[model samples]
Structures are given as C-alpha cells and as structure tokens.
Target: MKKRVITIICFVLIGIVQSNAQVTFQPGVKGGVVFSRLTNFDSDFMTGFYLGGQLAIKFNKLYTLQPELVYSQQGANSNYSDLLIDNYYNESIITVNNSVKHSLDYLCLGAISKFSFGTGFHVIVGPSLDFKVNDNFDKSYFYSDSPIGFDFAIVGGFGFSFPNGLSLDARFKQGVVDIYGNNYNTNIDNNNNGNYDEVVLNQSFQLGLSYSFDIK
Candidate 1:
C-alpha cells in the first residue's frame, strides 16, 4: 500500500514537471457536505461542511491534474453505557454512562487526477494530506492523547460536468493513519502496552458541487 501511494505521488510530480509547457488552466471553487465518523466505535455520523478551491491544469482533451486546498470539519457523537471505573481517589468502583461528541477541523491538500470519458462523465482519483487544525477532544478525554496531528488518505469519485462549468461528485475518503496509535486507556489496554489491539481510522463520504472558470 505504501509503495502504491509513493507511485501515485511520483506521477503527480511528473505532471508538475511538465507544466512548463503549454497547458490550459481552469480555476474552480467547490463546497460540500461531509458525512464523517470515527471507525471502530459505535458512533453516529456527524454532518459538516467543506469549502475549497482547485486549479485544474489540462494536459489534453481527456486528462487534467487538479490541485486543491480545502477546509473541512468532521466528527461523531457516541453514547456508551454500563461502564465501571474507580473513583478519582482510587477508593471505590462506580458505574457511569458516558456520552461524547468528538469534533475536528482540518486543512486538506490534495493532488487529484481527473479522467474524462464520453458525454462529460469523469472519474477522479487522488491522494490527500490533512493537517489537524483543531479538535474538541483533549488528552484527558482519551486517557492517552489527542488525535494525531497529520492524516494521510485516498479519495476517489465520479462526477458529471455541464457545459457551463458546473459539476457534481461524490467521493469517499479512507484514512491511512490511525487516530490513536498504540495509546489506549485502561479500559481498552489489555496488553499494558497502551495498545488497543485495533486501529481507529477516519472514514467519510462527501457530496460536492463545483464551478470552474476557463483562463488562458
């Protein structure tokens, strides 16, 4: 998987290297709603918004390489019950029900390759780098640490374009990095290595609309 990601990046870099030649440029704006959740937990999906811009470099009639910068908000809500825990003073055992809302904000940078087929239908595949800007959860809540700072993910989708430069796409993003890597609370750490024995990843689906302006 790592090797595949490296190969994709190399191809994108090659595209950048070729930009010195003549090409077509299209500047675009995009916005979407994200249905996001944290995997490995029974949590409800959180609906958030994303807004971004993209610059599309057209190499030929059927291909374009687009670079985008986006701001996205994501999170989930979880309700857990029947938990046993020692008191803060380490004196007695107590049962509690915990409900939490995890919220995160990120700045996402992506290089997406767009492949157009017949009749304006197209497919997009890309790699994304997400920088954690802010999150509502802290270390005390996780009993280990906050969520990871940077996340790597793959995004792919299909869309249709209109002659007016309006387009719509639906994409799914799967995180390659775990939100909690080897850090677990006593409730989850059975091996005492702070390992939860499982990985927690970010999964989300996006529906977006974009409009582009042609430039010389």
Candidate 2:
C-alpha cells in the first residue's frame, strides 16, 4: 500500500513539475508539538508530537502550494464513569477508569494554499487526508465497534518565515468525519448540558518549527 501511494505521489509530482519549469521548489522538514483530543465525549486533551517533510511549489512571491507528508501522534484521555453502553443488555453500566487513554497515530497527507502577507508572515488553509496507522482503545468501551481508519480534516494556520529558511507556525485541525462507529449515539451527554451529541471528531492544535532548503 505504501509503495502504491508513493508511486502515485511520484507521478503527480512529476506532472506538476513538468507543467511549469520556472516554478521554484523548496523542500522543508518540520517537527512540532501537538495538543489533541476527541470532540466532546468527556475527553481531555493529550500531548504528542509530529514530524514531516513538505515541498513548496512556489508560483510567485505571494502564492505557493505546499504538499506535506507527516506522521502525527494524537489522542484523548477519557475519565468518566457510568457509561450506559446498552450493547448487550437493556441497561448496561460500564465504569471507565480515569486513566483510559486513546492513543492514535496517523499518517497525514495534505496540501495547502499559502498566501504571504507584507513581509514574512503567511496564512495557510487546506484539507488533509489522515490515515490511522495505530490505535489503542478498549473494544467494549463507549464505542460499539471499531473506530474508522480514515479521517478528513481541514487545516488553518499562520506562520512567519525568515530569509534564512527558518519558520515558526501554528495550526488547528478539525475533523469533519465522525470516526465513532458506535451504534448508541444518543445516550451520553458529553458536554454536561441538556443536549446529547456523542459525535466523535478529532481536534488538534499544532505548533511547529521548520527549515527549508532551496533546490537549484
């Protein structure tokens, strides 16, 4: 599967490079701290890290399209009791400990449109395809079945770049897809309000430092 994906990426990059020879390509590497959690579900944020590389296809000074491949670690810490998981019986109460953690690792493929401001500041917005590489969750927890292996998310961020190729950026990623495959969706009150919405969506904030190398 990785080989197939790499082949497709190579073909796409070649096509893109051949479309315009005058465009500059800069390769960059990044490492970041990630604060992530599942939306609602009485979950708390967990800290992780992400590392990746990207290629900046610069069309001009103001516009550039960046494609990146990153490996990110993220998840949430769930500490709630008396979860009514009526999967087998009419009323089943499962007491989850405070230390139950959902650890997830994802391989993220993304492309963003970067717009530069007055000097070195830039804003980027894009979409990402995240594939779950690993997950550690109890099978008989609040989720009835296994979580989905893929997620679609939108990325929004801002960064400042220096002439020496150093940059600092922050990004917020929100998952649009509900990865929770639970059959019982209307039972729990995650937000402690009167409404009940047990939708499971991944949300994260990332702060990163990067350095780019000019390709000649």
Candidate 3:
C-alpha cells in the first residue's frame, strides 16, 4: 500500500512537470536541529538533528511545490521509578530508579506547498510520510519496545529566503497516527484506573537552513 501510494505520487508529479512548459526546478540541501518528544510518555524533549535534500518545482511566481527526502532523528528521555525483584533472591522487592533514552531515526518523504507572500517570504504546509530506520534505547533497566514502522505527520512553517539563495525555516510537525504498534503494552497506568497505556504520538519542532540553486 505504501509503495503504491508513493508510486502514484511520483506519477502525478511527473505529469505535472511534463504538462507545465515553463516550470522551474530548484534542488537544494538542508540540515537542522530537531526538538522531539513522545506524547504521553512522561518524557522530555530530546535534542537531535536532520539532514536532507529537496527539489522545488515552481509553476509560477507565487506558488511552488517542494518534495524533500530527509533523515531525521527524534525521541525522548525519561526518568522514572519502578518496582523490581532481585535476581539473586527472587522474593525480595526493590525500588529501582531508571533512566532511559530512546532515539528513533526516520527516513521521511515530504510534499510541501509554498505560498509566497512577498519577495522572500512564504508560508509552508505539507504532509510527510516517515519510515523508521532505526530505534535505539540506552538503558539496561527498562525494556524498550520498537515503535510502528510507519508514521504520518502534518507540517506547517514559515520561511524566508535571501537574495543569494540562502533559506531558513522553522516548522512544527505533529503526528496524526500512533507511533506505537497496536499490540504495544505499557506498564504505566497513567490514568490510575488499572489499564495499560494508550497510544503515543510524536511531536517535534525543526529549525533548518538550506542553500538552493536553479537546476533548470
């Protein structure tokens, strides 16, 4: 299903490019810092980074479409206490303080629309499809479960470009789907009603700089 969707998007974009005789293309590279956290995880945002490349297709002076491929790092850091049984004497109960850091990496494909207001300013809005490339948990005390393989997010931002083609943007991305698998089970009962936790979502803010140049 994901492959089909990607293929369809590609064909549509190709058709648009072919139909527009005066379309201009610009290719660029971008890198940035990401502040990310998991919602409902009782965690704090973790500082990470992203690097990516993009192709911007301009149909006219005021409207543009940009498709980007990015490698993004996102996750959270959490500290909590839990009850544990000693390995040596299985009956003895112990209160353990645990700190865990989860680092999730994704390869994201984003399709963004830019509505230019003035010479160098634009409003950007887009949808991104993300595939998990890696998931890492740095702790021995807590068990780390992998998140769902795919995620969907909505992104919105404001950007500015210099006359020299140096561009900068700040964006917010909010996950619309659960990052955790449906079978995921959590020991923490956040509601205090003796039920396992619900799904968790990803929330992030990104600040990036890019250099753009005309391709054709």
Candidate 4:
C-alpha cells in the first residue's frame, strides 16, 4: 500500500510539471486594415490600419489574458448637402450642396481574453480605450467644433498561433457610445446664414494580422 501511494504521488507531480510546460508567456505584434462604415451616415466605408503589440500569459488549457496597445484610425464620411450663402444682409440659406469626408485617429489600449480550442486555434474578445490623436476634415465647410466622440469600443476576433510564435488574427470593433455630441443639430438654414448644419458619423470594418512570440 505504501509503495502504491508513492507511485501515485510521483505521477501527480509529473503531470503537474507537464501541464505547466505546455503554457507560454509571449509578446506579439499585429497590423491590419479596417473596412469601416458608420451606420446611418452618408459615407459608405473608410479604410484604415492598426499596428500594435500584446503581452500574453497562458493560464491553462483553455484560457489566456492579453493586453495590447495599437495605433488605430476611426471616423466617418458624408456628402455635403448645401453651399452656405455668405451675405449676412441677404436672406440666409445654406443649401445642402456637396459631400465631405472626415477622419479621426486614435492611440488605443485594449485587454483581450483568449480561448483556445486546440493546437494553433483560438478566439479573442475584449474592450478597447481610445485617445484621439488627430483629425482630418474637408476644407469647404466650417464645422465649429471637433466632431470626434466615443472614447471606447468593444472589440472581438479570432485567429491562430503557430509553433514559431507567430499569430494571425481578424477582428471587429464596434462603438458602444454615440460618437456625435448631443448639441449637434443637422437643421438646414435656407437663408444661407451660417448656422447649425447636419453632420454624419463614420464607421467601418477592420481585418488584420498579429504575430506572437514563442515561449519555450
């Protein structure tokens, strides 16, 4: 009986060691383009890219935690509807006459939860926080304030990791908050006097690749 117990204890210890050996602590980088669009906005889709790195810690057979940092682009496009009548004395009417394009850039930080199904396959889901880095706007219209809103988004994706520590991933990010401020009024002033003009939001889809480090 004593001998049998010793054998069992040894087997348990060996199994624990083997289990730990299967896990990896890794760092990786990813980049890809987002085919993006804002729902209900005039512009169809915006193309942009994201580049970033992640620190991954494997906990067990099915789960891992990864924290990431990336530079991402986000925004929307719209057709300018009217030309603003410049004369103050004349009856003011700003007719919606043309189309416009705008863009916003962000430095994003995210946390991802990974669930692995088998060798080299995994699914990742998480949330991201974005800080506005820059903005691009069309020259013709005079928008009084910065149109960028929504400081965060929920992101999710799936991909696989190779034995060499390289990983490939495709992700989707969606805004949880309204990107436009409540003060924005889209009313058209027919008299051409400069007043509140309607504006649209830009949203899009992103597809990309990520490379991870191998831990031995």
Which candidate, 2 or 3, has the higher TM-score?
3
As for TM-score, the candidate ahead, 1 or 2, is 2
Candidate 3 lDDT, tens digit per residue, 71-173?
A: 9999888888988888887679899887777888999999999888777898899999999998875342464566778899999999998878788899999
Candidate 3 lDDT at 109 equals: 99
Residue range 1-216, candidate 1, lDDT tens digits: 999999999999888878755578899999999999988767889999899999988887699999999999887878776657676788576768887778878899999999998699999999999999988777325534688788888999999989898999899998877775443454444455544436677889999999999765
TM-score: which is higher, 1 or 3?
3
**What do the candidate models score in CA lDDT, each in turn?**
0.84, 0.85, 0.86, 0.72
lDDT of 2 by residue, 160-190 (tens): 9999989899999998777764434445456
**Colliding residue pairs in candidate 2:** none
RMSD for each of the candidates? 11.0, 12.3, 10.5, 8.3
Model 4, range 23-48, lDDT digits (tens) per residue? 77988888888776665555656677
Among the numbered candidates, top TM-score falls to 3
Model 3 ranges with Cα > 4 A deviation? 1-19, 81-98, 137-140, 183-197
Q: List candidate 2 stretches off by more than 4 Å.
A: 1-22, 81-97, 139-144, 181-196
Would you list the rank order by lDDT, best first? 3, 2, 1, 4
lDDT of 1 at 194: 47
